[model samples]
Target: MKPESALVLEELRSKLRPASVAQVGGFRPGADPLTSWFLKGVCLPGEGLPVWKGQPMFPLIQIRTDELPVIPEQLKGIALLVLFHNREHHPFDQPHGEGWLIREYATLEGLELLPELETPYHPFPVRWVSVNDDAPGWEDAWDIIDLSEVNDDTQASDSFFDDFNRYGGTKVGGYPMEIQHSVGIKDFVFQVGSEEKVNWMWADNGIGYFHRSAEGIWQFSCQFY
Candidate 1:
């Protein structure tokens, strides 16, 4: 690789942010999810949670923001974020918050643990671990500065992006590793990949993406092979 390209690659690498990854240890009442994704937590009652087969819906994920590593500045005061998927809705094709839901809490006072609820699949317990591995895929270039330097040399370009594929799994911050391609969601947040060990599958081994819209609303979508 040319020295100019190598220097540009180093500069580009400096822009990469680390995302906390899910190591997913065996069951525990509550394990630290690298302080990024807390799957279990107490919260105010989900008073209007949609019903399914006579049972209220189970939240797919519960994230505590008190310890989040990377997040938008506006969410600095938020206490928790929760996600719910309605079995009645399409995994990725429905309107935001209609089929899927993302709720953020401002405080934790008077909260309680989520009660046992029915789920379509076995909800295996998992926890998060911070990982230094995070890099934007070519698809995520729009979220970063111009890629002109990356395109400066084929070899340098190839070397930098080559790391993204090795990180195809659940992560916080950074970019969502593409199952098909990025949906171009703005203000992206975290993602959860289908875990075979936990039987968490999105369609045929897809990944779930959680992000925020321009209006500051959180949304959910899934992509699969």
Candidate 2:
């Protein structure tokens, strides 16, 4: 990892306390062993830190240690830009419209860190964009900017699809363009207004999704890889 990336990870570990553990490889419960181990090895439990949905939640963290030879030096700086966001549906308390959190971490530096890695492991690049009431229009929130627009074109073949596939999960066999992705972590709502308030939502990619529904309510959700 790059110096800045490592510093940020270390800082995040120190600042955010792990509420719940998640497993990465096998079928163990609680938290992923690798992720749990990484968190335990880095940051210890603390008080007063923000918890995921009033419970403990651990966001996936990817660190490129020297042991991983496949990681390219060019991709070291990419990890620093990892972003996470919350998804909420209308009517707040409906089961059919599940409200959860989704995180998307991209190496916006234009480097494919681990090419050989498979699903849930591929390292894609992403950037952070926020759409708010201040934005020119609400529709601008739906625009997910492609990183290739600013990076080199050499690594551009099927990158977005590969990214969406990796994060969203393998495409279901017969579905036209519908993809299914897992909700790795739940989101905590930080209200920004009163009974009628503006809540800003951000995604792991650093982009914010916002919309104005009927009755002046501002709704937001993050779209991830």
Candidate 3:
């Protein structure tokens, strides 16, 4: 939280939920997840590879939700979350396997990791970590408390939340790092940024956000610079 306009920021702050943050990186141990399998396909639902249009989808990140330090209510029964996207685009309105895929698991019971995919981004485990100072984007703020409600403090408050530099990072909790506009998409839980260590990068350095819906289903979107 920045000290620039702490006085008027409380309204925005109260609308946001704070949870334990986690970093999804560290390629050691050779068993970490989030490895890039761009061209290669993933075995989801135990049937066949997930495809979009005519191309196959690849796994972007794999999280053992049960491994997190603090599992939020939204992720209660989820044991694993494997995110997937087409080689080029991510059409949000499309169905499950059209442009992107979010594979959820209730348990790791019969799970298996494929052999060699020859992907550039190596497998880095998603682990719990401390969250840095951050707040939702201005649009997200406006939707929560409304700009009109803030009265004369509009400009200061907008600048505070819209500053992407202050809030951008790859972490599990807190607020999302918006590259463009804030998504009114509720239940802001985790954020993913291009990790350089394992050669992880989305678009020209995009940031992805995750939100748990009221139905326990996760909604996501990625924005790039």
Best by lDDT: 1
Clashing pairs in 1: 33-128
Q: Against the hidden reference, what TM-scores do the models get?
A: 0.78, 0.20, 0.72
Top-scoring candidate (TM-score)? 1
* lDDT of each candidate versus the true structure: 0.63, 0.23, 0.59
Residues 1-225, candidate 1: write the lDDT tens digits: 888767766766777666656665465544533233223434576655545545455576666665555554536677776676666545576666566667677877666666665555555454555656566666665456566766877887888767443355666676677767665536667887777655566778878887776677776777888
lDDT for each residue of candidate 3 in 1-225, tens digit (9 for 90 to 100): 244355456555555544445454443444333232222223434545466778666676666666565565667787776777666754644555567777777866666663334455655555565444546665665665555434456666455545423446565556676678875546766666777765767678887777778776667777888
**Count of steric clashes across candidates, in order:** 1, 14, 0
Descending-lDDT candidate ranking: 1, 3, 2
Please report how far candidate 2 places residue 130 from its true position, in Å. Answer: 34
Q: Provide the lowest-lDDT 10-residue window in model 1.
A: 32-41
Higher-ranked by TM-score: 2 or 3? 3
Q: Candidate 2, residue 53: CA error in Å? A: 3.6
Model 1 spans > 4 angstroms off: 30-43, 46-48, 52-55, 67-74, 148-152, 163-166
